[model samples]
Every structure is written in structure tokens, then in C-alpha cells.
Target chain A: MTNLLKNLATTEVLGINRRNQDYLRPLNSPSAKKIADSKLLTKRILRRSNIQTPELFKVIRTEKQLKYVDWSSLPKSFVIKPNQGSRGRGILIVYGKKKGSEQAWIQSNNQIVRIKDFESHIMQIFEGRFSLGSRRDIALIEERLKTDKLLKKYSYKGVPDIRIIVYNSIPLMAMTRLPTKESNGKANLHAGAICVGIDIGSGITINGIHLKSKSLLSDTYEPIEMTYDQKINLPIKGIEIPNWDEILEIAVKCQRESGLGYAGVDIAIDRDKGPMVFELNARPGLGIQVTNNAGLRFRLERVAGIKVKNTKHAVRIAKNLFGGSVSEEIELLSGRQIANLVEKITLFEKGKYKVKRKRKKLKQGTLLVKGLLDTGLLTSRIDRDTAAKLGFIDAIKSFNSYEIPKVFNSFEEAQAYIDKMDNTISKHEDIVRLAKITEEGKIRVRPVISVNLLIKGIHKNIEVIISTRKELIYPILIGRRELKDFLIDASKTFTR
Target chain B: MILPNLPHGIIVLLLFLPVIATIANFARYVLGIRTLGIYPALSLAFAFLLTGFRYGMIITTLVFAISSLSYSLIKYTRMHYVSKITVIYTANAIFLILAFTLFTQAPFFSNVLNLDFNEINPAGVLLIAVLIDFFVKQTVKKDWFTATRSFIETIIVSSIGFLIIRIPRFDLILVKYAWIIPLLIIVNVIIGQGSNLKLLEILRFKQIIVKPNPQDDKSS
Candidate 1:
């Protein structure tokens, strides 16, 4: 098992990671330049660049702002997010105003959260408990992006954002992060959002595209009703980004200013404003390799040591090397074969049997004995009734039965019979000698003899005091002493 | 056949004394305490363990008083970084000469401090060398406060280095788990990556503040 674990660690579950790193390392420059992370820096950069973002109604930075800011000023549709939060931990999106008062209603799962509850939730953000690294943070309220009609049927009350991996000033790959009910309306994959890679030149989605009929409002709880018929496709294919050239230019300028060789630029399109530079990332996630289903090591290695005089040259080089489109690569790599459902489980039992048959055969006439394998625990236990049932009735009678104490004393002398079936029983000693037999309208029986039992698997043996326990569900408890040989894999199932 | 190996033991003890003296001086002078002129204090302590306390203390006091008076006159002039270090060594040599002269003159001390000029000990010279190196580092740097801070850090680091060198048990364990060095490097890298928090303007939220007038701030 240890050898298996060592082998598993070395096995390549995914090949794209090694390729991506190889491609990125050469373009990466080591410099100490601070570019604000997405949540803080993107908002500032967008406003400076004259790009329209969600309207910020109010910011609660201090206790004064928290006290004076009017709740009534907030629109029915708004989003409250922590300014310094990451992985979408503290974001609340309000879908509509409640029936009574000026209170807002938030969609959490299938339920509606009241305005007071939402404010209390914001208090968690104010304390910075959910902030990145648990540092202090301020919360901001902004205008929520209305879910587009096309994507409305596919999502709950969540907004989707596009992530563009820009390396050395060129946009290499792009993906649309979609929020599912599973994602709790957050567009962060770490927060359960599904990442669907999109073509850079074209806006078509590559994987996990859901084409559903009903509007998002109707069935809030169920999975989006995907037909699997009229294949779900991204609507904006071949339609160039509103400001593609400008976005690329901003990425190049930002890279030069920040001195970061590799980066990711997140851009969102505002209904009124075209394309806004959302944020720039220094150490971008390697999951983009999985999204593109291409190895980054190969791409990174190809660009290594290649000097680019300008952004135009960099873009040309990137396009010439990694371009040609991913759809063809995906088809060629996967080979037109549908994925197999059965391949999900690699380990299978040889023969199939009904669940009922397996349970009955184990419980039928076998004597149940509970022992503590605890290298630490010093005892093993057995019930008298179980021993009698396992053809020990004659032995019990010769030892003097009816009463608990007499039966216990008689079984000590009969240790020779118990030793024949199992060799490890050393000796029988003092009986527990119970004063009274109390049963709630049930038959009471006691086992005689405290026996020393040796476990088959572990290094140590335990001397357990045996007694009948009728209420135990499993009828036997294997203590820690017996469990030394195996390391628990929390991901596996355990059955007796 | 085993002849007690007197020469080898003497050689090892000779090598060990300088390291012990420098460590003691580092703890006392740099960390701001007091100790006798480097060698006599270390030698007296070792001798007190070998001989009786009354005899060792008498010789130690006579030697320390003479060296302190000689070292006082040596600190008169300002010099360059390397020259300053030379001054410290010159001061120690003069102190050693004064101690030898005073010990020979004292009737009680001369009988107890029985050692020839040939046995004058290179370990004391090595200890003075360490002190000179430290003195040079402290005087040469432009930032006095930073230099002093580094001096304190050096003392602390060398103390740890000394303890690791002296203790065999700790040395063996560190040798066994040499892989810890690479693991520590990886941990430092992860810490470096995690601490980076990007600027607000780069994060793209635009509505937080109004534009600041740069001219007004400059004039004020």
C-alpha cells in the first residue's frame, strides 16, 4: 500500500501542467513590482482608463461610513463584495426587492434572504474574517450586472466573467467562468464556478456547454434543462471583442509598467461601455492549461530566450507558435470518441451479487466476538450466548449454566476447548461476577472467563475482559490496537 | 603501547582555546557586558578548573589590570576601516606584552603563571584576529545603526554556530536530515508568493475616490 501511494504521487494525472510551465518560465522575469490584485487594482485601472464598470453606490471603509450610509440608497439589484476578498468568499448579490418595505431579497440556493440578514452577512465581510489571509478589509456596494437573456436560462442569479491569459503582451488563451447552482452564484472556480475554455480569436466555448430551454427564474433548484439535442453554443462566436486591439494594448502597457513577464488579464464587457480591463494577475493559475487542454511546458519552452522588441512582435510570435485554434487540437487529441461512463470506477469486484444475499450469509450462524486490537487496549471480549449458539451448548451445561456467575466460572475450566479453534488464547482468569442480571423483557446471558486473545494482523496481543453486549449494532468493536497495518484513505469506503 | 599522547592533547587544547575566547568575547563586548582581556580570562578559567582557585585568581587579576591600562592608550586616533582593525590587533599585542612583563615582575604571580615565551599560545592570537575582523566590519559600514544591528545579529548567529559545532548529538541529527534545506527553500518560495497583495488601481474598481489634484497638494 505504501508502494502504491508512492507510485500514485509520481503518476501524471494531467500532462498540460508540465507543458504550460515550460512555456511560461522563459518569458517570466524576476522583478519586485507591486500591481494591486484583481479586486482592488482592476477597479482603479478601469476608472483611470475611462472604462465603465458596475456603478459603486457607496463604500463602507470605516465605522463612520457603516453608521451614516443610508441603506435606502441601495438599489433593489446590487452586489456587496469585499474589496480585499479572494476566491469569491464574501459576495452577496441581490436579485430583487422584497414584497414589503424597502428591504432587498437575495438568492441563496432556492431561498430568499431578507435585507437584515444580508446586512448581518456584510458584517462578516466588514470584520475581514473572509478577506484574503484574513487581513482587514472594506466592503463595497455596486450595481449588479443584469444576467443576459441568452445566459439567463443557463445560470442562477450570477454574473459570468471572461479570463484571458496574456503572456508577454499577447493574449494566449481565454475562458468564460460560468456560475452554477453548485457554485452558489460565484464566478470563481475555487468557489465552485465551472471554467469553460473559449477560443481567443473566436468566442466559442469548448467544454461543458449547457443548452437549456426554461428561463432561469422558473426552475431555480434543478440543473439547467440541457437538451443534449440542439447543441449549446456560445452566441458571440467570430464576433470580435468590442475593443480587442485596445485590450491587447492595455495588457502590453501594463506588463511593461509592472515588469511582469507572464500575466493574466480579466476583461468584462459593460452594456454601455465596451470592454474594461478588469485586473492583472502576476502568478496566474495553471488550471488554464487544463482549460485549453494543452501542455504549458511545451509552449513556455518554445518562447524561452526569444527576445521581443515590441508587443506586435510578441503577439505575432505567440500566434505563430500556439495558434491554429484549439478546436482542431481538441478533435485531434480526443480522436472523435465519446467518453466512457464505466471507466470512472477502475476497481470492480469479480462477480455481481444482490445486496441482500451478501448481508444474510455473514450473519447466519457465526458466533460474534468483539475484540480491541488496540496495541494500546489490553483486552478482548465475547458474549456467552454467542458461544453457546456456536455448538458450545454441551460445554456450557457441563460448566453449570442458568446463573451468570456459575456459567462464567464453568467457562474458565473449558478454556481448552476455546484454544483448539484459535491458538492464541493463553489462559482463562477471574470472572466479572456480576451481582444482578437486568434485561428489559429480554433474555439475559453472561459469558464466563476473561481470555487473552492475540490479533492476527498487528505486532501486539491484548488481554480483554469478555462480556455480553446485546445493544451493540455491529455486535463487535475492533479497537485501535488492531488497526496499525492500514493507513486510512479518507476518499475510500470501509466495509466489514 | 599507548603513551598517553601528551603532544596531541596539547595541540587540540591549543586549537580549542581561541574559539572559546572569541565566543566569550562576542557574548560580553558586543552584547554589552564585561570580560577580561580575551586570553588571560579564558586561560585563567580553564586553569582554575585544572589548578586551585586561589592561585589562578591571583595571576588572573594581575594580568587583567596591566592589559586594561595598556589597551586604554591604544584607542587614541581615528583611522580607515582596515587601519582601525590593525589598531585593535596592535592594542591586543601591546596588552599581551604588558601582561607578560607584569606577570614576570610580580613575586606571587610569576610562581603560579609558569609558561615560556614559546608556549605564549597562538589561540590568543586567533581570538584577537576574530575581534579585529568584527571591529573592521562595524567601523567600515556607512550606516552605524545598521552595522551595530548586524553586529548583534552576527553574535547571535555565531553563538548558534558555536553550539552546533560543540554538540555532537545535534550535528549528527542535522547530517541525517539534510533534505530539510531544500524543503525550507520551497517553504520560503510559497511564503513569498502568498504575501503579494496587488494595488487597488490594478484591481479595476474605479468609483471609490474622486481624482486628486496633484498641483494643490504640491503647493500646500
Candidate 2:
């Protein structure tokens, strides 16, 4: 059955994934590229655009500056980072107040980093050890924003931020990345953070939950029919994001400024500040697909040819076109109503179809047949009681002749009697070794039978085992291996 | 019996060696400690552990002096960055050749040059080449003070790298679980996002701000 499912099943449901790099590769925009590749330029552009980012206190262009700066002037809760640093390399986050005149403490993984340790760390950063391409870089210390209350429970200790993918000035998708204890208080999935996709129309997260175990309600679940439970459904359903319109405008303006057609805007909602633009990403992760559980290929294709006039119109189109439609589509694709229902089977013999009718009509009595074709089964099998009633009693006598023990009781004895004769007459080989035998219900019989089968349509002959307890829904169990050629239209009613 | 596979062990070693070199380079460049390039700084530390610190420092200084002279002479003619690095690397190789000559002819330096050259350990030579390359590049790019500062940063970074590599506990953990790479990448991202200050800018900001220049006064 496993083999058959592997061969027959279509992978259409699994097609939607977050890491679909190929689909997003062509939509790479210029603005996103500039922001990701050049940090200095990004800071300059953001500052010029009136976007609130971490203040760049100073820049060190030459060695002269290295000799002159007073290290004591640095603030307590400041962060130091490299300009060309990609991923999260070469960054130092300092926290806590000064205890003594010379020594200041830093908070890292709930531990205190002394001032000496901090200075050494800064020196490492200055050396370009964390810089991209191993080029020399300037490190700047800026104020760290205090995180808001709504995200406090979701995040460990780091600042939780929102990632919005903007394409052609349209905010296509958004997700809030939260820090976890596992992530060591860093709100990066690669750093152990979990990503929760946000519904664009409603500020409520589409798929996000506190990392606690519970039986999820039916309506809140995504990809409705998918049996696997992975993503968390956010509690808030339709709260409008604070600066939705402004965010859209910023995205459009950034697109125009950076000259990139597709980009991702990272925005942090500070407790004091409303929505501060953090940084721009040129190559955004495809993991957002898994967060949303929808393919980007379809969305990208839909927007590719459209002429986007303004940010408002683009947002309208994105909301009207995609919105929650992808989620619905995913639900439909994974629902259980479409799955196939097939049973396992074992075949024992090969034979031509022969029809026999009673020649004369007599008093009504149950007329049993020795050879009964279980067409529902992939392999031929016989019922013991029916075989005995049909006068195949000698079949049971021949069981001992094949060196097989007569281990059956009164009821199984009759059934085995019929099975043995059918095996002898049909030239069927019993290859299945009996592992265990037990009575299921009122039926007293050998439940398992081993048989060699030659399927009618296909040329391959196979050995299999069968259980006859299931006589109501299916008289025969056809394992998946036997159903190689014929396609089963599960949606259609069985013909025979 | 629980040791890592040969290929994986080799890969770990390869990764660890470069990281040690990089860290040493970083320390020397930033912290202002003097060490023979990233490789030599780390290698010397290792050599110090095997031989005594006095013996290790003596061998390191002798090799560095010879390699520096060869590198400076090679730099008399201008070359591209790649070519310059290549020249410095070749000079280090020549230094190794000279070491053998000194070992055979002069018994005084023989004790310091007791390492087997026939073994031709590329990792060791690569380390020396890295140190020489770093030293030569710094000397050429900036004045002596900047070069010296960078040298310090290199030493700090290399020492950290060397210590990380040498620690049996860390080595065992890293070897057993390679998932640390992703974790490192995440940490890198967080650092990238959190940091706003450039270390060099902090180091230089005071001088640039404190002294009002004559040219600026004239312009004003």
C-alpha cells in the first residue's frame, strides 16, 4: 500500500513552500539590492527620507580617528555593528547601567558582560572580523528601541520586528518574527526565533502562537484538511495595523528611491515610536511561503504584468486579489474529502472467468460455491464455510498431505478444508508464513491466508498475505503494489 | 570509538584553522597587540604550548624577521592586491627554505628550527603566509601606528580563535553538532541589526571633533 501511494500520489499539495527561491529570483528589485548590499548608503538614504532609524553618531574614515575617540562617551544601552555585515554577524548589543566609575555591565543571555569584555568585543568588531568580504568597516553605536507590550509575551528578550514583502509598491505579505529562549533572545528564525505570518488586511497574525501545546480549534487551523499540525493560529483576528497606510507609502517611496521592483521592508514598532523603518532587504527569505503556506509563484505571476500607478492602488489590488484567498486555496487542496479509499489485498491463483447457473430449481436452500471470485480483492481467496457447503471437504483432508499441520478447530477445520482444495486445484502457492492467528468476532476461522497471485491485467506475479475478517466494507484487501496499471478515480463510484 | 569520521574531522580542522587565523587577524587589527599575522600568532601560541613560550617567541621572531625582509624587498615593485598577497606568500615559502639552510649550516638556530620541513604541512605554511600577508598589507596601506594597531587586533582575534580551537570541550561539541553554523548565522544577523556604531568611528570621533583646524577656521 505504501508503494502504491508513493507511485500514485501527486505532490501538488506540497508545492507551496517558503524556500521557493526560483520563483522570487526574477522579481529581484534594485531597491532591495541596494539596501542589503550597502549599509552606509541605506543609512544615508533612510535619514534623508525622514525615516527614523538608529542614529549614526559618527564615522571613522581613517586611522587618525581610531587614535582620538574617547571610548567613555559611548552610551550604556547602545548597539555596535558593521556596515557591510550580512546576516547578524559583527553586532554587539550593550545593555544595563554603569555600576562603578570605570566598569559598565552588559546584558547578554541574562549574564553581565563587564566593561573590559565589552571593549575587547568592540575592538574585534573594529578589526573587520565580522565584516562582509573581510573588508574594513566602521562600527556605530545607536540607541536600542524598547519593545511594545503586544509582542512582549511572544519575544524572549530581543526586539520583535515585522517583515513586509513589497513588490511593485504593493505590500504582498507580512510576518512578525519573534525571539525565543532557544534563539537566545534574538528575533531571527535562523537564531532560534519563530516566524508568524500576518494577515495584511487585518493586523492579526494569520499563523502565530505562543510556543505552547494545545488542541487547536478547527476554524483557526490553516490548510484546513492537512492532517499535520505545525503552525500556530494567531488570536487577534482583525485589528488594523497602526500605520498601515504610512507603511504602504514608505514601501512605495523606498521602491522608487532604491529603484528595486521587489523588496522587503523591515519595520520595528517601538513602544515610544509608532513604526520605525529598520532596514531594507533585497533578498528576502522564501520561508515566508511556509509562514503563509502559499506559493509566491502564483502571486508574482498575477502582479508581474500589472501597471501599478500608486501605493494606495497597489495596496487595494493586493488586498482585493490575494488577501486571504491563498489560505482558502491551501485549505481546499489539503481537505480530507478528496483523499482515496482503498484496501489491501493478496492474490493466490490465476484463472479464466467461468459462469455456472443452477440447472434445476429446487426447494430454497443456501447453495454455496467452492470457487468464489473476490473481485474486490487483488488476489483470489476462498471462504471456508462456503467451500465446505459446496462439497469440497476433501480439500481439508489434503492439507496434511502437503505437510501442513491441521491446527484449526471445528469452524476453522471446515474453512481450511475448502482453502486447501482451492489451492491444489488453482495451483496457488502458499508463501505467507503464519505470524499470528486469532478469532476476531463470532466467526471461528483461520483469519490469515498466504497466497501467490498473478494479476489479470498486469504480467507481474506477487506473493501476499490476507485477512478475511473484513467482510462488510470490502470482501478482499488489495494492497497498493498490485494496483500499478489501473488509475482509481476516487471521486467516482465503484463500477464493479 | 566515538570519534568523528575522518572526512568530517578534516573539514572541522580546515574550518577551525581559518577561523583561528581570522580571529587572530581581527584581534591584532583592533586591539593593538603585536603578533605574527593571524596564522603565526595562533601557531606561535600553539607552538608555545608544545615548546616553552621563550623558545616559541624566539622561533616566531626569527621567522617573522626573515619573512618580513623578504616581503619588503618583494614590495619594491608595485603589484595588484592579489599579486601582492601572492608575493608575500612566496616570500614565506622562501623563508621556510632559508630555515632549512640555517638548520643544516648554523647549529645556533637549529634548536629553534627543529620542526620537520619534509612533512610539508600546508596548514602551518598557510598560517605563516596569512600572517605575512596581513603584516605586509597593513604596512603598505597605512602608517606604522595604524599597522601596529591592526597588528594588536589580529593578535586578540587570533588568540580567541586559537583558544576556541584548542579547547577540547568546544572542539567535541562543534564536531558532534554542526547545527551551530545556523546558530552562528542567526547571531550574525542579530548583531548586524542591533549595531549602529562603527568601532573605528568611535576610536576617531574625539580627535575629529575636539581640535578645530586652521583651514576650517579660515573657511568659517
lDDT of each: 0.45, 0.51
Instruction: Give fnat for candidates 1, 2 and onward, in order.
Output: 0.00, 0.00
Q: Which has the greatest DockQ?
A: 2
Candidate that would win on lDDT? 2
Writing each residue's lDDT as its tens digit, candidate 1 over A1-496 gives 3443443333222122232343334444444113434355556555665555567887778766676767777777777888866556667777767678575574555457765565565666666645654566788888777655544444445766667666546666666666766667766654445566555433455543322222211101112213221235233222234454555555565555555677676665555555555455655664554454443434544455678888767655554455434434444565532111111111111121112333533333333243322233233343445434444444445334333232323344334334342222222123323222223333333333323222221223322233455663332333443344333222212112
Give the CA lDDT, 0 to 100, for residue B202 in model 1: 13
Please identify model 2 stretches exceeding 4 Å from their true place: A1-32, A61-63, A71-75, A100-102, A113-119, A208-242, A325-496, B1-220
Task: Give candidate 2's TM-score.
Answer: 0.42
CAPRI level of candidate 2? incorrect
TM-score of each: 0.40, 0.42
**Reference-based lDDT, residue B155, model 2:** 43
Could you say which candidate leads in TM-score?
2
